[model samples]
Target: MKDKLKKLIIIPAYNESECIEKTIENIQKNAKDFDYIIINDCSTDNTREICERNGFHIINLPVNLGIGGAVQTGYIYGIRCGYDMAVQVDGDGQHDAAFLQKMAECLEETGADMVIGSRFIEKQGFQSTGARRIGIRFFTWLIRLMTGKTVTDPTSGLRMVNRKVMAKFAKDYPKDYPEPETAVTVLHCGMKIKEIPVVMKERAGGVSSISMQKSVYYMVKVSMAIIIERMRRRK
Candidate 1:
């Protein structure tokens, strides 16, 4: 069943010139079965040049759309290209390409609409700092309370969605602080969500976009988004 599925890997890259090549090389070496595209989110760096030099397929946005917008662009492409499933992998080389096939297989076996590759499921790999972990746990509890769903890694970017949800996301995905809010949206839409344990590495290169100053803002913004989404009608 997995062999018959049309899978695509969406790498949402923003100023990842240092790590983008390694990320694509890993995918080419490990996950050759899936087609891939890099969504270059109008990086101020030489990210676009690097992709063009390597002759990799990419969708270069004119303006800097946030992570959510970049990922939605990939979803739009996947749907238009007749893909059955789309898996998101970070361009910072944090997510392992080797686990992509496992995620797809888990989706097939469980019949879930989405599968999240989680770090806390087995508590392995780069668990981050205590402050960040505390924030993640807060969202984890909030999701369970609001949606009656337990997501150990609600902030995880490594996710795979079936075509049904992919089409919806392509039309109206969250613009900022999206990952956690999207999880709530999936529950509101009555889509099945599953989390599988997977190890994650620290970013291979470049600083993380979410700085200490922005972390607080990020938490409040995403938390409010998730709660507010509960009152809206599901699409």
Candidate 2:
């Protein structure tokens, strides 16, 4: 019989005190066999205190490291803990953990190095709003234009990776604006990526401060970053 994969769910959270419990509970209910660690990005709110109170596995950053840094920390921790695979699940609870098992199975059964949960493939979930979707589609086009690979939802945060790819991310990952850039980086390294349709809900709690202008600027900056990433030859 084939051995079971040891999986770790890496949840990066900042000021997610209200949503962290629900996120973990979702994972616990949906992905019962996997272990998880919460990378608390030195939240000013009572995020850390709550995690401690609930006995959640958490690593509190001494300072804020942004999304990219927090996620990289999780990959490093997962690798150190000897997990065979690591899945990125956002703490704000947008990513529905119910699809996590399907993604893991896709990775193992199809020999895919990475699998992404895309809301576009089947259009089955709370897809991004109009403005937000413009950015998602822009990155989708940019990644395909540069890499010749179609990643329909390059901005989607729910992703899974095998150990080899996990180690690569642990060594070098984009600091911010990571999702699109890392997608390009993975293809550049000749890794196989697969996408599965999954439903995504709005954040379970908290609020986003990003305005329309900020979203436009975010698109321009990440487009340039993806181009730069595509140019660099992987060592």
Best by TM-score: 1
TM-score of each: 0.97, 0.96
Error of 1 at 64 (Å): 0.7
Give the runs in model 1 whose Cα sits over 4 Å from its true position: 233-235
lDDT of 1 at 12: 94
Query: Which regions of candidate 2 deviate over 4 angstroms?
Result: 1-3
Candidate 1 lowest-lDDT run of ten: 226-235
lDDT of each: 0.92, 0.89
Number of colliding residue pairs in each model: 0, 0
Give candidate 2's error at residue 197 in angstroms.
0.6
